[model samples]
Target chain A: MPAIVTTGITKSFGAGETRTSVLRGVDFEAEAGEMTFLVGPSGCGKTTFISILSALLSADGGALSVFGTEPNRLKSGDLVRFRRDMVGFVFQQFNLLPALDAAENVAVPLIIQGVSPRKARQRACAWLELLGLGAHLGKLPSELSGGQQQRVAIARALIHEPRLLVCDEPTASLDAETGRQVIELLREVSLNPERAAIIVTHDDRIYPYADRIAFMADGRLTHVERPDPARIPARPIRGETQP
Target chain B: MLGIALKMLFGDIVKMLGLVMGIAFSTLLMAQQGGFFIGLISRAANTVTEAQGVAIWVMDPKTETAEGPTAMRDVELYRVRGVEGVRQASPLVQATTTLRTPQGRSSAAAFLGVDDASLLGINPRFVVGSPEDLRRPDAIALDQLGFSRLWPGEPLATGKEIEVNDRRATVVAITEALPGFTAPVIVYTRLSQALSYVPGGRNRLSFILVEAEPGRDPRAIAQAISAQTGLLALTTPEFQRRTIDYVLNNTGIAPSFGVVIALGAVVGILVTGLTFTLFVNDNLKQFAVLKAMGLSNWRLLGMVLAQALVVAFIGYAIGLWIASGFFDAVNQPFSDLKGFWLPWQIAVMVAGATAVIVSLASLIAIRRVLRLDPATVFRG
Candidate 1:
């Protein structure tokens, strides 16, 4: 079974004369152990679709299931719990809380899950170290570079060890080299046989890092593209990659 | 989540301090103005407090305050003295007259008349001379406060004669007494001497100060005095309330102080409320992110309330400290602001106002955070 499956998911905004549809019958699936990329131009409903899959937004119409549970059918409170316990999100702007140091920011998900703060910080420290941010754990978001900030956001997303990790243009803020380093880091640290990573991006530079890329337009999935077999990495990356 | 809320609130040092200052000023305004009002009104009961030996105060039905007591028939004292629990009932005279110093500077002075033999209504600690000295010709025992007004910066030495209502009045002794509301300096004299100074009819007795026998309830004795003499009677506490009530209802004092106290609360609420709302609106995106992170609207509301609570707690403590210090600075017994105290009610008032200001100020923020679009995090 796919980690996330959406059939005929529809969403719209506004009302009356100004009403506009954003998503029209988009069917998508993200597979476990693979980093699936949902790539589209601005206003293509990529965020909305991933938001539905993450249980952050309810689709106006759909049959949506995240890890065999239909998020659309869950109660509002249970939907929040589903999002908190089963999914993690990485935003495009690297939305780390400016007040907290990297370790505290990464510990947010665990704290929300009722983990003791000391244990949460320890787990956050381990994850931050895994993402090559061990030395920067005490630095605030403003004190770090954009690349370091994005790594912190990634660490926050992965800290709770959710089955499905969702990224909204996670590398959108980084430079060419930094974006490559972040995508490679995500591929190495997040994806496994039991857990999956889904990224929404239009950055052609990071396309090779994704196992598959879904292209969208006008709120509908156009097609999915895969890398040439010869260009694929010989094996998955498991540890730190120097930028 | 609570930790995150706290971090977010304190992260912006300037904003947090601004919020705390707003709350603190509000608390200070309410507490301090209320203290002054409390201090001012409590002065109306100065004479009642000065008469320590009197447990029950008997006056005419028309009399509302000690300062405005109408003279009752002298025979009324005999009726009050006849009451069952009354150990003694003294005919007390209270009148305000002008005291002309030797230098020709004249100021209003209150004269308290007591029974010469018993000295029931005019008990005070003597600074110079003795109570018996008042029996001398035209002699008066002046309060230390009155002594200062009569002869400014003069020592407590006796034989300082001053004109009372254009007649010779000698300051035979100096007695330290908290100044009365009508005048800072009060003259303690015999009942006949007080009656001679003020022009009046046969009924010159202002009050019949009664003492309840040992172990007797003053409230019951007061009731018996009123029923027997057909006069209004009140225990000390009840008389104090009557005095305060008279000031509140008849004079411009209540409205004057009420406006200031109410204005302080209004301005505090507006300022703190606006600042709190502005702070939340400025960080709308952060709330959106939290919402996107699956925080419930209830949790979001709790976060804003928590921020409000921190501000209220810090502000109230600091504001009350300053208000208490203000009271300390103005509490001069020799001056007119005697008997001024910040009661616990004022603290409760400040705390109650703080809670209200916090809740009102955070209402908009709470509503906005509750309705925030979690999808807004996707924009920009």
Candidate 2:
């Protein structure tokens, strides 16, 4: 079964003459156990589509389900819980709180779910260690480099073991080498038969890591493609890739 | 979440201090102004409070305050002594006179003439000499403030000669007395000596200090005294309230202090509210990120409120400490500010006002956070 499936989802902004429709009846699907990339130009509704898919936003009209549960039908409170327990997000800018050290930033989702801070931080420490950030757990986001910050964002996203992980230009801020390492880490640590990731990206360098890629344009899903097997890297994408 | 909220608030040390200072400034203004006002008005009743063991006062029916009493006939003192429950009724005089130093300078002084035998009204906390020394020939006790006025820069001593209305009066003792509303200096002398200093008719009695018989209610005794003598008689606390009420109702002191207190609250709200809003505006992206992470609007609101309360607590504590220190530093034996105090009641009331200021200030920041959309995090 697919982790998320949407049919004829639509969304818009403003009202009357000023209103601009951002999503025009889009249909899409992301199956479990694989990475799906939503790629398009700016203003093409890629971020808006992922926003709705992760329950950060609601579609004006849609039939939407993640892991067999319809998100569009959930009440306000239930939708919050649905997002808290099932979805993880990594932003292009690596939206880690400036005041929080790495471990505290990574512990946020579990803390949101009423986990004691000490235990949440313990789990966060383990995750950061797994991502080669064990020594940097006490460092604030400002003290981190781009690659280090992105890894912290990934650890934060995966800390609660959510069923769906969403990334919006996660490596857009990193250099080519760091971007490849971050994508390899995501592939190794986040993808499994019970969970999936959907990345919205403008960077094509990390394109081969996705199992399926959906292209969006003018608020519509224009096409879907699977990367050629020979083009996909057979070896580890970087030397320091985590297990 | 709460920890995150506090960490976020304290992350910017400058803004947090600005917030704390806003609250502290207002708290200090309200509390300090309130204490001074209370101290100023209470001076009007200082005479009533200082009459130590006197339980009731019997005066002319028109006498409205301790500072200005309409003289009653000396017979009225005897009449009050005859009332039921009257243990003893002593003649007490209240009047203001000019005192001249040997240096030929002068300041207006509040003059009290106590009973020749009992010295009922002028209960002095002596700084030098003894109360018994008042019985010496041509002797008078000068208050510490009055002595400073007459003999500037001189150490307190007995036997300082001062002139009261051209009468040679020797200050045989220096006494500690609360500064009064009409004058800073106080002179205590025998009734006969006081009568010699002030020019008035044969009816020289100002007020009759009454001590109720043991186990008798002073309020009821006061009522009996008023009924028997057709004078206004009041228990000590009742008379103190009457005197303070007269000042509060008749003078602009209350409203002047009131304006300052109100301005304190307004300034607190403006400073705290504007700073908190700016702080929240600066951290808008962070709040949006939290919102996107599945935190509810209610939780976000709580975080803002918690941040506000922390600022309020620290600011109020700092303000209270400074205000209390002001009261402590000046309320000394000879300081003109001796009678002023920060009442715990005023402290508590200011705290309540601080809470109100913080809540009003937090509203702006809270509104911004609540109206924020989580998708803004995705935008960047």
Identify the runs in model 1 with alpha carbons over 4 angstroms from their true place.
A233-243, B123-138, B147-160, B172-176, B215-217
Residue B9 CA displacement from its true place in model 1, Å: 1.8
Question: Model 2, B372: alpha-carbon shift in Å?
Answer: 2.3
Number of clashing pairs per prediction, in order: 1, 0
Point to the candidate with the largest TM-score: 2
Per-prediction TM-score to the true structure, in the order listed: 0.93, 0.97
lDDT of 1 by residue, A30-127 (tens): 88888888888889999988888887788999798778899888998998788778888888898888888999999988887789989999999988
RMSD in angstroms, all models?
2.6, 2.0
Evaluate every candidate with DockQ and list the scores. 0.66, 0.78
Model 2 lDDT on a 0 to 1 scale = 0.90
lDDT, candidate 2, A1-243, per-residue tens: 677899999999999999999999999999987889999989999988888988888999979989998888899888889888999999999989998999999999999999999999999999999999999999999999999999999999988988899999988999999999999888888877778789999889989988989999999999999998677665443323332
Chain B only, TM-score of each candidate:
0.90, 0.97
- Model 2: CA > 4 A from native: A235-243
lDDT of 1 by residue, B243-337 (tens): 98988888888798788878878877887888888889877888887777767788888888888898889888888888888778777646556
lDDT of 2 at B38: 90
Top DockQ hit:
2
